[model samples]
Target: MDILDKLKNREEIYYPIERNRNTDLRFTLYDAFLAKKRFERFAPLFMEAFEEINGPCYYKSDLYKSKLGADVYLKLDSELKVAHSVKARGGFNEVMVKVEDVLKENGMLDKFDELSLNDIRKIMAAYTIEVSSTGNLGLSIGLCAKAFGFKAKVHMSRDAKDWKKKLLREVGAEVIEYDSDYTYAVKMGRLSAEQNHMSYFVDDEMSEKLFLGYAASIFEVAEQVASSGLIPSDDEPLHVFLPCGVGGAPGGIAFALRSFFKDSVRIYFVEPTEYPCMLYSFVHGEAASVNDIGLGGKTIADGLACSAPSKLVFPIVDSLIDGFFSFNDESILRAKKDIEEIDEKVVEASSAAALLAYEKINRPKNSILWITGSNVDK
Candidate 1:
């Protein structure tokens, strides 16, 4: 059976809480301006970093109206490309829309011509895939694969939430569930790509595309600071704290900060004490496995649960990261609660982890904290 048929055969997964279907999440014009300002402020930093690695690329920033208000969106400029949602916890459809926008913008409508037909049956095909946590990425990857005459697969852990798995199936990804966790899912995905002779691994953990996509966050922050008159003087370094999981986000941020600020800013990394692969690596002065440190622990922050550091990110971490901070689940939870109390907005446990560590470290005033994602399922 074809992917669409297979998706039709799969059952829909339900969640205990009522899912928010309203796409008109409200954001004030001022808020939109703030987000755009942030993007503009950081655009140069992102451009410079991306140029160093992958040449020139265009950027798109817009507010996505969702049940949770406006979400910031970003993408890489490529002939056949994928767009990623900033929300770490958004589901499949959100990701699909972003990819569709990219395809539409690039005028690559012909790429999907063959897949639009029902008669053609091909055993294997090459696909430009995009991946992220939850099933949202699966939807985009599957849709782009279908539109562009390619096959797509999404890797998810057995621990992945049930709704996410269903969403993956709905989006036409052959959802491959690993026996272990998300880290293992990534390893399995690499192997599966090799065995299937696929065009590329839509790797979030190690791919330059994925890392550079996130580095845009740093650019946005830099712009926000400068425009808001928050930029420190030349002699005063901007200390940046970021939460590390597989090291993609932190690695990207560090690369941008180091390139722009050089010795002007200090970069600090934060990881959950339960799965502190990055911290262990930093402390040992070399890359080390999570198993070697025996640091595994259960936490609500599943996104940060990485068993190993990415080989691609190690060099950047060694050179750019100044220090590391470790925090327990309790601290992350407290941070989440504190953010909610202060802003009345629920920040995910992982998102709050960086700010939590920053508070604990008591760094110099004006230090910047990278609030990575808003994927808190609760």
Candidate 2:
């Protein structure tokens, strides 16, 4: 889907941390008793499945830093996984949770150590998974689903790149195209799940599984930050700027960072001005689409062309985000163009959004700008 769309499910998931349990991530597969187990089972695999051995965040001295007037570091998630995007973390996690569910439901899996790959594959083959996406999410979802032996389908909108759909199809996933935008594609995907048995929809806007999966990246970032010698304290605060789409990735990571770094961190979300869905929803006190706010046009930054901020991710973003900032397509294009011209690197407009966050706000000194995707068409 072109333009689109938290886990506001349970009460205590957002509560104070007196319980010594992780309030940062609560999902179907996680609880106070099972948190460590969940992390142990998933974190290593999150690294392994996504080729995260060199999961990197680098400090850069560039013209963008001068423009932002901050000590800027880049979290290069654009280069992550086979999918080569930030969605790799969340998409893989969602499918693995389904793997757990299928294994448990059939009374098959006991421990990860005891599981047989052959047996797991046999079980996974019976399940089918579906998700609606603009592009990047489909790559991660399709790749994960294919790897796990599940029949996968991606329902998408016109704003999605043709190459993304082609890549998904090449991997044996059914690509369902729609002339409509992201929200419409998502509704159709939801309808199919309602009608089909043994089918699961990986809802980008609202899946707790996806939210927590992306949240797990904080551990990787913490490790990277430590190695980079970047400290998060009042004297040298860690400022994170993430590109906001449906808000799952940015919100998940932001809240998790807040739990880890607390007051020493400030998280900001950057959105395309034409489709500042999160900004509108955050300020308006409801689910407000781009059409609701009278913004139109397909964008070069198709990833950020979301109509509404995700309901599932909104509360976390509202609570944890230091600010929500918006910029025009021209700004994003210029950022992408300038970076390519200066650094001789080709990055998607979405990747440039994090750096553009600095231009909009009065940012802090030590900053981390996450480059979320590299899937740009030349």
Candidate 3:
């Protein structure tokens, strides 16, 4: 059968392609450097806003020397303090960027460092932060919004977990449930935000702020990996397997890695078989959805149940990404189980996609499987 037919059958597949790496000039190393500096400037604000975070969200990488039998490490973002997911990196960064803009407009930017949490919250209360998500991003946005006293409205797709919705509500966000899929929720959320003057929408599909936030984290990733003595070279390439959703997080990461490591790293995105939107979009040379190909677009990996890849992200990372790995829910469940058994930690199905990719791919001397989030239910 053809690749499309194979994808339709929900079969496990790895499609590798030569990427031109230098094709996109819209985002550059300078952009990443600027984002890194911006993140550093917001460190104090993040700590003051979310006391639980303590400091900037730190990535925890554990080397599994015996388990994988190779130089493999799990970059566990699931253990992050604030939102307990990789989404917190992007979500919190975007919110802080917006907050910074507001503070500057009000002549409080100079005084921002001296302002108390309540002082900033009083200003933030005049605005609303909005977004649509399958789960994790919504939770991140809601938590960040309420922490800064901004009203939050999360448009949730039907596939979003009940626990995520409950957590969002508990954080004082208005959760609007949609009977349809992620695309529809985004459309509604965008429209609603456009109609309001005091609303800021964290567009998962198109927000450069969110993309930059994810991209900036790669600086920490590179530092952590280098500290562990696994530097990527010509013969010893670093293989990074990232879990994909609408392509924002993974795409940002892949772009930054390509800029940093150049040809020394092989970046792969892992997606649900039923919703391999990024893979399909990459192969077909256009923006398309799983629904366009008659797939159900539903999966146990709710965070990865996106119908279409992000239009903004896909084009930027199209030349940087090396390949795509698509797997069924059975494989995700099995990977999750294996991870919990081996690491004694529970991860969400979406996060387990990277682990499955590492297992399916050829054994590399150095590989990093980025665990995106924890299963809050567990």
Candidate 4:
């Protein structure tokens, strides 16, 4: 069968349907309505995001779903070039998957797995690096290190969720807690990593792989939009608003959109007023640390409560994004209520923050808001 047929026939093992030998699982009309509503709400956003970025061809993979995240897929081009996955926390898993694919292609899968642990240790030792963060990127790297049989150390801010800290420990990572915020934890992690022998800091903050992998979301969005026939006319530009954490998602989406849309799409970035790293960066003409911002230390939007932007993503944001907006906690709460009322879907505060910004700024009718993830701890 052709690739298209294969994709169409790809059944989700987790949601199995019975055949003649058994029986097909039937869905009520209500179920169908809910499903359609979800698709209508999300598909258009994905499609427009992809088309404006000029992604021509792609395929979807089930990796993200397997991890209990969203049902995400990796996109590929006609030449079978793998572009990016739609996973929110695209960090170590993204890197490992690509590396493993390359190794498998070279007939070195077993050797690659065997060498990965030692290789990681050597690299860490060389760089004197210790990875630290309160976010998924750091957690993913720590998990990867443990999987590869390498020791991992992480520093998390006091405000970090308890579950995250527990998960880090469950993966055999050495976890340190800081009394201060994320930036302070990062500094402590860096200093400790530098002082210890055989320690290498896997600074997710500066890692090109992390930011590049995160950018892949746009490629999928581009392809989906093109396939859905929702590409905006050449005369009018699509406006895209992305929520900001450490500016990774905004930076990645902006970079891809810039490459695809050129001057045809206007990009806006939104961040919590409590941590407006991207907005601060844009206003300052360079990437600025949020450590000094009084409100930068905390937010109900845990995913977007980052106090600094990644150095790698800053340039992309500076050049590609047209505007930046900051939303307060009260506004985010109202936005969340509005989304739940409109779609009956539960979205995290981070995602709602983007919508709130759009409402506050009086965004264009043809605008797109990236509701990035639903990883709320509530």
Candidate 5:
């Protein structure tokens, strides 16, 4: 009912990471391997758009490690290229791959390849793509869709920030605002795309490309950690705290990390107390949504205002993540203010969720928190 009450109600859940999984539905090392290859294919597109993608963009963000009394490092998705958020990774990959899929199916692969960038624009302009989002994903999809000359439509819920909506419009996407939640926006986007043959829908709840794009971060994180000479052994385990909305970003990364580190890594997802959808879903063992409990989906962290866990990522989340925690709006603001004063870094509300989780863990030697986004309004 209240902030701390939500934390008190948390049902702790985790699964052991191993080489083989008995269940057909649960994710395994093979899935991580396949996801890596998918990411490699799209990583080039990311580089083409913004000089660099997976490797050069991620770095350590400044945080008050001593104040938290843990050796905490931040994976700076806040400074990532494109839309300055983790969403860009997934959104870009989904749009690019979808365009290619349509081209290949139409028997235009050779024709599409022969065209120059400007010439390709003419070929791409005839198609359309749509996606539903709270905010950041729309920015990524809209910007990427526009780049490839698609008539883009972004369906947004009331929870989306005004600046994000305006940004999508400025980038040539048809911005449709709904007086509803994310699920409703996504439903409408799906319907609209289904009505037209040339239209493609990037379903955030089920897009494997989006999941693969997020999983790609694992390679870079592993490389960066290895280069820094910090080995997370069984004695001193590695802890990573991440912000969760629809669960794709954290779930994908968790799947990869679990495969890479085996039992040495622990992944935790943090969320707005009112909208801890994934925690409820994992604990309930089926599907769950905030709306089922009469939540209107209000939160300061707009990017994390999803009312439900994504169906595609929920199974992987249940299989991979080590923990989940929720906090109130005030907690997000307090952490943002305190960390800004202490660390001299300005992070958005969703980005500060990792810091909230950091305080809750008794991590050993190595720990990394993901600063997933910073698309605050000016």
Candidate 6:
């Protein structure tokens, strides 16, 4: 069967023909280095803004070799402080960087440490942070913005969970619900921010700052891996499976990994069967909706239910990602259950995609399953 037929059938694997590690990328290693510095520089503000965030954003790695019968390590971004998801990395940093920019522009940067919380609040109350999300990203942005005393507006798609919307509102964020899908929510949210000079839209599909926030997390991961005595080399390369949404989170990490490992690491993305937007974008060489392939883009993994790949992240994903996998709702749920049984930890469906993808791939000795988040109310 051809690729289209296979997609319709919900087949597991698709490797793009144009994946080249040596491809010339517009965003260089120096850019990622600067992004890392920016993330680190904002650590003090992140801690001050969110009481739940005590220290630097770092992940724990547990070797689950025996239970899963592989040499795979579980990289638990799910245990991330604050938002309890990988979105906390990008979403929170996006707001923090923007806040810093505002402070610098107003000549308040040097006085940041001397300013009281109420003083910071007075300054931030004039601006608003806006974002569109199916669930996790909105929660991250809303929680961070409210904590920093900035008004937040989250444009939520139809697939967003009711609990997520409720949580945003409880934290003082204005939640705007749309009956349409993620793409439409993004369109409306961007338009709304454009009309308001005081509002800043955290564009998941095109924000380099958001991408950099995600990319900076890789530095922590590398340090953890080296401590565990598993180094990525030509003979024993690392295999990483990440759950992909609109592509910013996974694409950013993949870009940074390629830069660091230089073909010594293989990165794969897993998406819901009908909503494989990144995969579709990689194949077509441009950003397009999954609707073009006759799929409605519905799934149990709501966080991965985007209809189109990110235009900003696609080129990076295309050049760096080694393979793509798609799984249906049943498989995702099954994987969730199986992981709970094996590790005694219940993950959300979106985070379970990495497990399912890891099982299907020909994994190397140093394989890592990147668990994005856990908001499942078990």
- Taking all chains together, each candidate's TM-score versus the true structure is 0.64, 0.83, 0.95, 0.66, 0.86, 0.93
The lDDT per prediction is: 0.51, 0.71, 0.83, 0.54, 0.73, 0.81
Misplaced by over 4 Å in model 6 are 16-18, 57-66, 375-378
lDDT of 2 at 57: 21
Model 1 stretches astray by more than 4 angstroms: 1-150, 375-378
Write the residue-wise lDDT of candidate 5 on 1-378 in tens digits.
543244344432222233234334455556555655654554544455555455534222223243444566777777666677888777777776776776787787757436455554577888998999988888888988887778999999888888888878887789999999898999999999999988989988888788777876776788777766678987777888889998887877777787788778877888887677887676566667866665545788888988889888786665576667777888888878865677666678988878877776554468887888773435
Task: For candidate 3, write residues 1-378 as lDDT tens digits.
Answer: 798888878888999888775585478767766777876776776777666665665322343442654688877777777788888777877887888899999998989778888898999999999999998899888988898889999999999888888888987899999999999999999999999999988899998888877887777878777888887986878999999989998887888888888888998999999899998887778889888788756698888999999988887655777789998999999888887788777788888888878877766778988888764654
**Per-residue lDDT of candidate 2, residues 266-319 (tens digit):** 788887776777766765667778666466457778888788878887755655
* Model 3, residue pairs in steric clash: none
What is the C-alpha lDDT profile of model 1 across 17-60, one tens digit per residue?
12122323122233333433433443343344233223222233
Candidate achieving the largest TM-score = 3
Q: Give model 5's clash tally.
A: 0
Candidate 4 CA-lDDT value: 0.54
Which portions of model 4 show Cα errors greater than 4 Å? Answer: 1-89, 93-129, 291-293, 361-363, 376-378
What ranges in model 3 sit over 4 Å off? 58-66
Instruction: State which candidate has the highest lDDT.
Output: 3
Task: Please give me the total number of clashing residue pairs in predicted model 4.
Answer: 15
Query: RMSD of each candidate?
Result: 15.2, 7.6, 1.8, 17.4, 4.1, 2.1
| Model 2 poorest 10 in a row by lDDT | 6-15
Q: In model 1, what lDDT does residue 137 have?
A: 40
User: Candidate 4 lDDT, tens digit per residue, 229-340?
Assistant: 4555547666666777776546655666666666677677777766777656544557776655444655777667777787777755545666666767777888777766
lDDT accuracy of residue 104 in candidate 1: 57
Misplaced by over 4 Å in model 5 are 1-70, 106-115, 375-377
